[model samples]
Target chain A: MNRRLLLVSNSTLYGGGYLQHCQQNISDFFGKQVKRILFVPYALHDWDQYTKTARDKLNSLGYEVDSVHEAADPVKAVRKAEAIFIGGGNTFRLLKALYDNNLVTEIRKRVLQDGVPYMGSSAGTNVATVSINTTNDMPIIYPPSFSAIGLVPFNINPHYLDHDPNSRHMGETREQRITQYHEELNTPCVLGLREGSLLLVEGNTATLLGTTNARLFQRGKQTSEHEPGTDLSFLLTDAQ
Target chain B: MNRRLLLVSNSTLYGGGYLQHCQQNISDFFGKQVKRILFVPYALHDWDQYTKTARDKLNSLGYEVDSVHEAADPVKAVRKAEAIFIGGGNTFRLLKALYDNNLVTEIRKRVLQDGVPYMGSSAGTNVATVSINTTNDMPIIYPPSFSAIGLVPFNINPHYLDHDPNSRHMGETREQRITQYHEELNTPCVLGLREGSLLLVEGNTATLLGTTNARLFQRGKQTSEHEPGTDLSFLLTDAQ
Candidate 1:
């Protein structure tokens, strides 16, 4: 009944994955005491691959691994687990599954009420938002639309670092997409997290955890630039 | 009828409303050559204010103005309108009305097929996306959620400069929100536009319009950081 959440931005098991940094961040930043890890394959790449890799990694970490697929089991999973790690994949799919499974409500309850040491990576982090419009997902075919778990007051835009030197696809810049978000409702805080970055939301406080810089936005204004040391919710709480 | 398409981000109007930049952006950007301006009040603001302001601006520009509501009589208003200037407001509402009024399909024909110079400021700019989720509006109250005119592939988050100077509220930073978008989708582009910034999609190519920066992203990786001079839809087109 005592569980902490572990959200991961990217899974080490995915192709072209960044493992060393993510693992180190998890082990060091979060207590090494993380005994069990849960994978919400909703956001995972190739559900089976994600599961197997997650299992192996958790096993290597010397912890139990569980994937939440229950139609309404997010609460049950969190209640029984010690550490939870939501992986990255398709945000809409993950969110849809969560909604369909009615896990969104439970995740909020587990985190806000239970203070489950949470670990959300990428889309996992996105679920913390009041909506998922902050995410990079296109929502082409169906509607992942803009609904979110509202775990955190603001929204999460994951994989939010500057461009990578190793890749070559030029898409809409992250800032541009976020600008689109701000265009709609600029009041909510939009978080941009880099690969290994983390936005830790504790009781009444959210902290930015990462080695890279992320931009903070409010409505039409851009707050200050934040690195690892930034207090994610200082100004947020102050303003509130 | 020949018309110009105006895209605006903010929905509030007059006396330092949420969309102060709406009127100014239009006048300063587009000269008096605009024959007529059509106002799109999408974000649920006072219609009278938006209409009055838009009409006054159009008069100042020596052009005609219509609130689109006028044409609600026959609904063929799209065909009769010449030069449309969509003011900043709720893009979701604007898109919904467009669809309900059967103006969405007409807009595409006029702007895309007929080569109308489409100009938008804030929320007006966002609805240009394939869907409305790219907007920055709060999902707290779900509007008649609908897809945009599909003028562009990606949804826009406009007025995207940085944090507010005076105001406190927080959770995820802007960067985190965009990163979350990237992590969730492989295709959707998040356009981060500053106050004066814009993404002009003409005939399939999207050009950056303004003096700020634009960021492109994809599946957890940032593609490029574009300054004001950068041309958009270069990579975005290829991705689509």
Candidate 2:
């Protein structure tokens, strides 16, 4: 498969502006070859507002954004786009809109077949993987299916947090949830990306980018941690 | 509909033993007439261990425990139960098992029509509501439907936490997630049950119980805080 994806953990980092944490990486990944990017803001309730936010942020980074919500033919828009960016909100709502609008196959074709640069933040990062099962967002709406675009072979848990030893909350920790996910489907390893972390996939090679470390959970193996700049291409080496 | 439910936010609280926080209520709700309680440990991965834990805990409270997993005909076990207690674990796994075993209708009938007392904690509480859309558990496995046993007319978000003003995490807060749920289906309200909190329902009247307050999110209504003794019967007044 020919795929180029810049999957980010979050759109905004604490104490930073929107997309500020990964602005440089976004610019470098798209490069000078791409000008206008198609934005998919269906994860949120207000598509226009979400598009404006992405537009303003990307504009500051030297790119133009054409929102899919504004297009008369969304499928055609995906085909003509130079690159694609999906903003984050509720994962279930995002996947539902993708299926409802029939953009799942179109977006996948543009990324894998055409090799259009694809960027996603949080919920967007979730849909790029095998499925949205690992998302931290609420299932506010019922999507037709949990299956996603499958741009990568593994599942990504964005905005992943470590267990807080000092906290008194009784809910399962991120690690425990991922462990439960492994219990259901042992293959297709789960990768936990902390805020400010990202995975940049170019063809078959994927590298961990940004300032934080990523946690990897696989069946029958101890949870492992990899730092930024680590080669994660092994994740994309085989299809699950 | 004649329904009696004790939907608890969590089975175990911090610094407490299993079901320790809600043991007194469990005893009071079941009363002297209900001696043997049927335990549904399907929410967890280890049914045997979960049953043993519930049996030991309920035995200490002067009630005999019978787990449904041990029964050859689970639906028959639910039909013959004096009282039903569902322990907490992964909500998706619990709902999937319920569908796979064809227990959703049986459990609902036993609780609503037969007037058998139903007790639940965390994931168990989630399944008693209108749908599992408000649950905090991951979608490790997909159920046939997001629809759950409508023991109550509303949805539940267990282990609900308030936004920490000082925290830097950018993920949506419990309140925001419930708000998104409202965006999807605003009619059936989403109730956020903080740890150590539970809802006690007898007939058509439901009251908030436990040490902490519960947050109620309804469509087009401001989020309201209800004290432990607050009468929440309005939530169950009408069918959604």
Give me the candidate number with maximum DockQ.
2
Q: Which candidate number maximizes TM-score? A: 2
lDDT of 1: 0.59
**lDDT for each residue of candidate 1 in B1-240, tens digit (9 for 90 to 100):** 232334443433223444344445556545656667665554444667777876775676566777777555524666665555665554555666666667777877777667566666666676666666555443323345556776765656665535544422223445555565555455477667655555544454556655457766555555567786576655347464
lDDT of 1 by residue, A1-240 (tens): 233334444443223433545675566645666667666777644677777876776676566778875325566776675556676655666787777776777776766666666676667777766777666543322344456666656666676645445532222356655665565444477767655566655565556665567777677565557777676656335353
Off by over 4 Å in 2: none
Q: What are the root-mean-square deviations of the candidates from the true structure over C-alphas?
A: 9.9, 1.2
lDDT of 2 by residue, A1-240 (tens): 678999999999999999999999998999999999999999999898999999999998889999999999998899899999999999999999999999999999999999999999999999999999999988778899999999998899999999889999999999999898887744579999999999999998999999999999887789899999999888986642
Write down the worst ten-residue block by lDDT for model 1 chain B.
B164-173
Model 1, runs deviating above 4 Å: A1-18, A29-33, A70-75, A141-145, A161-173, A183-186, A220-222, A233-240, B1-76, B79-240
Q: How well is each residue in B1-240 modelled by candidate 2, as lDDT tens digits?
A: 678999999998999999898888988899899999999999888899999999999999999999999999999999899999988999999999999999999999999999999999999999999899999989988788999999988888899999989899999988888888787645588888999899999998999999999999888789889999999989986553
On a 0 to 1 TM-score scale, where does candidate 2 land against the true structure? 0.98
What DockQ does each listed candidate score? 0.06, 0.85
Instruction: Give the top-scoring candidate (lDDT).
Output: 2
